[model samples]
Target: MPPPESSGPPLIGPLIAQLRLARRWSQPRLAAELCAVSDVPTLGRHEISRWERQLRVPGDFWLGWLAVVLAVPVALLVEAATRTRSLGTAPAVVGARSRSALLALAQRWLLDPGDPSFAAATGWLPPTGPPTGAGAAPPTGVPALPPTGAGEPPPTGVPALPPTGPVDRSAEVVRLAELRRLDDLSGGAELSGIGFSWLRRVARASSEATPVGRRRLLPVLAETAQLCGWLAADAGAPTDALEAYRFGLRAAGAAGDPALAGHLLGSASHLLASVGDPHGALVLARTGYAGCHTVASPRLRALLLHRIALAAALGGRHQPARCALAAAQRAADRVEEGREPPWLYWVDGPELAAMTGRALVVLRRPRRAVALLGVGQGSGRPRSGAVYGGWLARAYLQLGEVEQACAVADDALLDAVRAGSPRAVTQLTAVRRGLAPHRHRQPVRRHLALVAAAGPYLPRPVTGSRPDPTDRTAPPVGNGGADRPGTPARRGPGGRTGSSVRPVGGRPNGGRAARRTDGRAATHSETG
Candidate 1:
């Protein structure tokens, strides 16, 4: 077989070495941490040393793990490595002892207790000096700032993305239609709002133009107004997103697009699950799943079923969730092996795996769940960021790896902030709950304090009693002695529940529904 041609960029080992140095971690420490948290168990310290020495190019799994653990994007790692080669660093230059010194220095800067600044500040430091050699150069092929029209200096840091030209109304209409399909599949409401806002802004801006422009803008403008509802719903503002979807449906009816209207309704049903109304979510999912079967593509129908399964799982109905997931998988399999409609483009092998993983974890097979979803570990798509991290957190928690679970949960929290997703917030809260049992350990206690810090954004459950964040006292860890006469029984999900999972929704569904919303649904109207 012929050798494969290099495509987008080169993967250089020295760059990975340099980044590891920059973080101040020894090869062993990095390897140990990754192995502790990973789904696959093939890695070890010696193997990591080999990769760092350029004896081997670590495959996708290791690369992905590095991306998450280092808290840098995959593209940045690739870019930094190529830039290093352009500067001519030897591939084998970084070694155990040299890396150890760098790690020691980094630890001093980031974690030294003797330094007063370290005591006062969070666990990061300003770069001590300018970057050297290839690392000093600007990232390859990234554009420099264009001169401002008014001679105003360009804003600092990265340049703004180039502006798109006047809206393509037809394309906007098509995209709006596609957004509904995504909503139906994901059961998230923000999809409609995002689509609606994008279209509305375009349509309103274009409406004042000449007759031809107005004609060009009308369809897009109308679609935007309709889309507001779905985006609202997905973002947890169900009532508002619902209104937007209904308005869009009315427009579709007027446009003689029964199929489009059906798709919008289906999307609405998908979002009902996010509001603690799984039965309603299922009703919506089934309605959309069956309705999409007629005018929607097979991919879209499969997506609808997937959302139904997710809702059922979250609602604590295992049977329907399994059935829906199975049907969705079957439908997904029927899509031609290599071909898919544009509307169905987002559904792929990893996404299907992720949805199935979520269901299985809820079904109490977290080990299998991690195995199924771990394929996405290093895929580097931002859209899968939350699910990928959430699955890892869940798996680690289930496996009784408290420290690893906490770290993964931290990753999930950071990803949620980047994605600006409230659902991510709730999921992270569930992870925090899972870590609560270890609150007496210094690191876990520190993590719990951080969880309390997120209270303003992640609002705690209103239905049940919880330890006061202000208490600042550690929970008892280790096996409980013969219980005090009046204390509640210490029940755990699969025996790990004491530390992770909470009573929410006025009851604990064996710790699966760990986030409580005080009987009030998150209305996206507040933030969407």
Candidate 2:
């Protein structure tokens, strides 16, 4: 293994550390496992330590073995290594701890704009800085915003603002809502950079406005943060999402809008649940619901309850999960058009049905899940369709309906590719793992091939508990939970399956017809 020509801060080292820590493996253990898997005992704990400390770099031989043992793609490892070699003597890439510190500083800035610490925390800010010179090219990997003529709305999805004037709060609110609607068509990966840019603009505006103007702008700031966080999470940038949520929570607090704060908490909870932190998710969901129960609209209440239900199911609190789902449904039934917040325009009956169906699937109630998931698969929304369809396919697999599962998974894979949603891809990845035992079947093999073909369009598999494609004993597909892949499903109370099985389901809906509306009322046609 030849070392790089020039010294640089470790890029691949942190990634390797994260992967090893995620599996709770010590340096010696990882080294031993590498030797065992590759039938080469030349590497020792000292070598592993040197690689992790950036004192040495792993060459092709070690990289291949690491990829095989870590269940990560070789391309990802090579990219990290390549970056280190290219950026000689560059500062270290930000690690998780640094990211968390920056996020905390951002939240604090939102809480107290006059705080001095806020000024120092701007080093690694989002790509929201001033634009480059006219006709100059944008930096690599950052998309250039379209130029707009004077008096025209900004070519960016977010609206433009004057340099010095009283801000038009109502107009800005409407524009923000419009910007959010774009996410339904094009998933967050494409819009996250734009969303962060908008947020930076809003934050600057808030800082410059008068006290009265600042108060009005705070709500807008909170709303923008919420959207940015959602986009970041969808783009597989969980740290960015968390920062946005924390910032939004502070903005919501400053604005005295507990309802919006609750919404932010729920959004954060959803992110937590997606990343395999069910207990933390449940706590946040419950806290959010408790704080704003008196002020939240029926739809908002329903959304919070739905978050709680999903978190509970994922955490294996079956009874509370079911109860929360029932409450969410009742709240949904009571939703009054034109009374709810505009940001929640997407929380219609079908959406709730889909959410409930997702919970039921996690709870291992396949019979009940199929009917609800069938009704809730988002009409004309490819991302939502892919997400719900993935769950529906899982239900079919649970019921021993291989052909049906393959058919549904096929549609889901297409939708996932079309939508370009990492979340949808993650769901489909689980479904693929579940079908591993049935790979001998023609349909399963075809579906697996399709998934492989779509790999370029999809995000890499996440770091935790990824099952080997050839491992027939891989755990059943469920919501990404704490259970490691290939671990046997444990029985819980009443002989119910534990976290190893996806936590999802709801009571049977008795074949209720799905209400097919455009999600929002006619007056809010622009809203999602």
Candidate 3:
């Protein structure tokens, strides 16, 4: 096997490290976990450390072990290892056709937790948005939920609200509206981690807090699923997010509401694109947008096409990206503010500018990126605002304006910290790494220290890997230093690598996502 140069941590290493940390398992424990699942009599913690440190790949032989132990897609594990290896080597400069194939397999891990066909995506076109309950199918692994008639009723003492009375239904609606407003203020998660756990709690609460017929229940579930999906991705949990989206989709279908279903699927597609699953994102976006086009207002259609453009650009489909972008602009031009959906208030001009700039950056058109991303810098929405600021920093870095990048990075660090976005934090760290040659300078060092204070998993400084003649594919040699992947390995209990490290990331900031300063994909997977 060709060993790629390790200018930075290979894909497998940091992910192994992060996933292991998420499990709160020490290296030895992970090794043991592997052993129990593997045919190999035993694997050693030392080897696991090597894998995390990018010293040696376990090859395809160990993917099943790692996948089962980490509870992630086995294909994803392979993709990580492959990406890291590719980076260590330089791009061979393949054709567009070959490139798209590689891109599809990049971070496009089929996230449906129960989709047996997860890794079997055919040409990256996923199920398009189907009208809910119009022969909508459940994921392969989801056990059929019982009919409400056969389902258990609430206990006698359990709380029950009058079914769909004007006042009772309005109470739930009031709470939902409040949550949305508060979420905007708090940057997505509040009332305890806007994530899978929180979503579950809310779902349970809604189920028990009110008694209603299918009419009321479906919309509630759809809305809950939508928020939960966002939160799950926000907290760096893609699989969980995918599950939430699928459930929300089901609810929308059951409610026979194309508006809700289209919105949910479109948003999910946007998240996928942001997370490096652009093909899946594109497919989902197309599915949802097509259905919504006739029914949704022009502004909403623009938002939908905006997401599609982003995914296409990231996937290296320049023509499609450009076409979609143009279409989105045309749609935007035709917008009628009065006819907007409740959720589309956030999808205005500034957001459009930001998304466009982001797509430009991924396509490596830095000049265009700089202009638009700058406009996006002060977006009031904290999450995308922080990300847009990061993009600004990256655009500056690409133009070789180190000082400007530093200034923007500092601003981004603050916003990202407030937004609790791990990806933005790491993107900022990559800026620092790009400035490694100038680390002797005060601004870089000062900023690095401040970023370090943000959280435990903030990127630690790392020395460059020694060059290897055999691996010629790594990106053009940088300051001879780059941000090495993996948490600093400290010996933890039982002589294992650090397990106390926390996983960090906001939603996969993939579409309209900023690349690291060195022009590498910020990450194909999680950020922190």
lDDT (Cα, tens digit) per residue for candidate 1, span 95-123: 11222222222222222213332112211
Candidate with maximal lDDT: 2
lDDT of 3 by residue, 314-350 (tens): 7788887888888888888998877886666677787
Question: 87 in model 1: Cα distance from truth in Å?
Answer: 65
Models ranked on lDDT? 2, 3, 1
Ranking by TM-score: 2, 3, 1
**Against the hidden reference, what TM-scores do the models get?**
0.48, 0.62, 0.53
Among all windows of 10 consecutive residues in model 2, the one with the lowest summed lDDT is 518-527
Q: Clashes per prediction?
A: 19, 13, 12
The alpha-carbon lDDT assigned to residue 514 of candidate 1 equals 24
TM-score, candidate 2, is 0.62
